[model samples]
Target: MGASFEQRPQPWVTNISIDDIHSRDFLAISKIHGRWGGFETLEKWVCGAYAGYTAVCLRDSEGKLWVGESRHDNEQGAGATEVQYSNGDNAIFVLFLSLRGEDVIAVLPWDEWWEFELNKDDSNPHIALLPLHPDMRAKFNETAAWKYAQSMNGKPYGYHNMLFSWIGTINANYPPLLDAHVVASVMTVCNQMQPAYAANMWNEALNKRLGTEVPSYSICNCLAWDLPDLIVKTEMRGSSFAELLTIPEQDDWVYSDGRSASCVAFVLEIYKAARLFDPISRSIQVTEFTIKDAYSLRFFENNSSRLPKWCNDGDDVEFLFCQIRGRYRMELPGYNTMDPYPHMNEMCPSLPPKYSRPSNCLKAFPMM
Candidate 1:
């Protein structure tokens, strides 16, 4: 299933020149409207406002534009085993290839491609973003960015920690017809059916929290006999399910397959290497950044005057980059107001008490 664009919207920007965009700029692609992978769609519905895909722009010494993205085509695939590169001839090709033809187009620095391919087709659209702060923009180390990208080039996608990254609370992360109980029940079944897979999936994380060395094949047995006691004991120790379930992501931690970094995680880790989040947000765990959280970090160029003349020409909507297609309008929600908890997501401990877990979070238990 591809994205539907029957009522194509007006192009967000006009006469965009490749010269306007610079290296280290960011791109937050919107969620594909009608894609088959329900997981990303669910992420968009839950996180809101363009929580689909993210990639970084880099330029070589000769000043050729290249995109660095952690792309996982499907479950059966090798799983983002390398940092995918998309250049002039294959940028658009890779975009469609990665996203499975979602009615989206990528903008590159190629003038001929831009003029002939994009200008000729009004239905396809693209957007661009840059650092908002002059100091941060100046501090962007293109060398460091490339180096970091190269380092993690062959690491597997962070599928193991993906759910834990967003699921800070017991209830908030689940969409309709799903909750903590439902997740736990599904996990219990998975444990019974495929203990090793389930163990690698989450039991190891649970074992880490519980200070236990329970083996993978015995996980189902432990779930049946020991998990309830562990839950009760956890409550007795003054901890809640939320805290027990919240696994802090470690950059050095190697999973069963390999070191893991999701799409947004890969982007933020590159930003960390480039010193883009220096001075204040350097210590943040990149894995914790959802697509929404990453984009809302108040780092992107928001001022229209500072942007290209074409980017600023849109009258109906103020440009924070551009959204060329989508049923709903795009917004940056907490834009420029990312105070107190700048780099962390809404579920971070640094947030105020109001952001803490609900009372029910204390009472919740994993299904047996």
Candidate 2:
């Protein structure tokens, strides 16, 4: 039987202007909720809960607004650079490579970017989130934020470590039709298609976990095996694929000859550099964050009075932020309630056979 998908309602918008977003200075965070296309739908079904695209909006000293994000252009494939809006003049260059292929990191004018994002799709909803701390604006390190952004300006999007963010457990984290076996099967196929790409993405990560330098010849030989045979061979080596996969060290991870950061990871790394998560979330790896985890952090502004005038705070809005677009009401189920779980992703496979997660770890969203 085939699965039927529900068509979500159209998104609603307010008269909110770019000025309102600029008012928050370098602290405004923009997010789009709901699927825009096949890729985003797959993302929601696989890793994400509710949110789609996320970026940091910064207003520099000269009052110029900018948007920093890690994005992929489907048409470009491995050579993809520059996200061109329907309006040709509004294009942003792709500065770095992404592990998945040629995805790039881009920083572009906020007015142009924001307008493009709002009008990109009528089906998706958007929101602008601000920091909750009253003194965040006064204490924010604009220089450091800009410096960190520039440092990662042309780095690859963290595609190699993307799965680690969602697969906290061997089976629980997987959605319908997905499991460790399916993942291994996919990896086997990928290995057959591009040995080098598979080596860089999986072999290297597995090597790090095994703590032994497995030569290229050995890895290639192992990759040539069938799915069941590969698993059996992996067991013979004394480790499961789940155990061999580890959480990536965000600041230290190097792939495709450069550093990598996914869209959410890119945003959180900027936050970490700015010291926004100081003292409490300092030990948390920014790379481990999913869109749901990033938005749930307590750093966002919750006071209704401080939000923009156009923000609809009527009884319908569940979270602190205003719904600037989309037909359905936006909700962040675990907002500000997540307690940092040290190496939570790494402990997933170690859990009891049927247990989904440890009691102390944050709960994942239900499958949609």
lDDT of 2 by residue, 111-132 (tens): 6665765786344444545444
Model 2, runs deviating above 4 Å: 1-11, 22-36, 72-102, 120-132, 135-139, 196-201, 212-237, 246-250, 280-282, 313-319, 339-359, 362-368
Estimate the lDDT of model 2.
Answer: 0.55
lDDT against the true structure, each candidate: 0.54, 0.55
Candidate 1, which segments miss by more than 4 Å at Cα? 1-9, 12-15, 33-37, 74-132, 170-178, 193-200, 207-242, 280-282, 312-315, 324-328, 339-343, 346-368
For candidate 2, the per-residue lDDT at 305 reads 75
Candidate 1 lDDT over residue span 1-368, tens digit each:
12233332454444556566677777665544245235566665554534466766666556767565665333333222222344444431122223232121122334433353245423332333544455557888766676666665544556656666666654566556766566667877887788777766676555555566454446465542234444566677777555666545555555555566777788888788887776655446677667766776667665656777766354455756644333444555555444324335525321221223221222222322
Q: Which prediction has the highest TM-score against the true structure? A: 2
Name the best candidate (by lDDT).
Answer: 2
Score every model by TM-score. Answer: 0.67, 0.72
